[model samples]
Target: MPKYILFGDYCENALEKRTPYRQDHLEGLKQQKETGILVTIGPTKDNTKVFGIYDAENAEQVTELIENDPYWKNGIWTDYEIKEWIQAF
Candidate 1:
């Protein structure tokens, strides 16, 4: 499996409205974790940005998975960047 880093910022308005869908989004992420896809996820301490890492087969597959996220579907994240990552440590 290849590792990927997903970087993005949440939409201000959407973040305010995302509480209702948080559980669903978490459930989806939980499934991914069980499948060994999600490595870790969290928002920056300041809460201005969000980022996550995942182990997937490829970028396309990862992108597909991200597109299915409840947050993404609900417009919580309006912009994002996905890139292959190498963890040398």
Candidate 2:
């Protein structure tokens, strides 16, 4: 599997706007984590951005995962960019 990085910008007042969908969003993340696709994900401390690491077959898989997130559907995430990453430990 390949690894991908996700960089996303939050909508204006994302903290407040995200409340309605937060539970769904977290649940989805949990499910992804259990399936071993999501390595890690979280918002910036200031809540302006979101970052995620994913292990997937391809960029398309990661893209679909992000696009289907409740935050993305409801606009808590305004936009995002995905890039294949090389992880060197």
Q: Once model 2 is optimally superposed onto the true structure by TM-score, how far is the C-alpha of residue 28 displaced, in angstroms?
A: 0.3
For candidate 1, write residues 1-89 as lDDT tens digits. 88999998887765577898899999988999999999998887766577999998999988898898888898887778999999999
Q: Superposing every Cα of model 1 onto the true structure, what RMSD results?
A: 1.2
Q: Lowest lDDT 10-mer window, candidate 1?
A: 41-50
> How close to the true structure is residue 6 of candidate 1, measured as C-alpha lDDT?
95
- Write the residue-wise lDDT of candidate 2 on 59-80 in tens digits: 9999999999999999999999
lDDT of each: 0.87, 0.95
Q: Which runs of model 2 end up more than 4 angstroms from their true locations? A: none
Winning model by TM-score: 2
In model 2, what are the clashing residue pairs, if there are any? none
lDDT of 1: 0.87
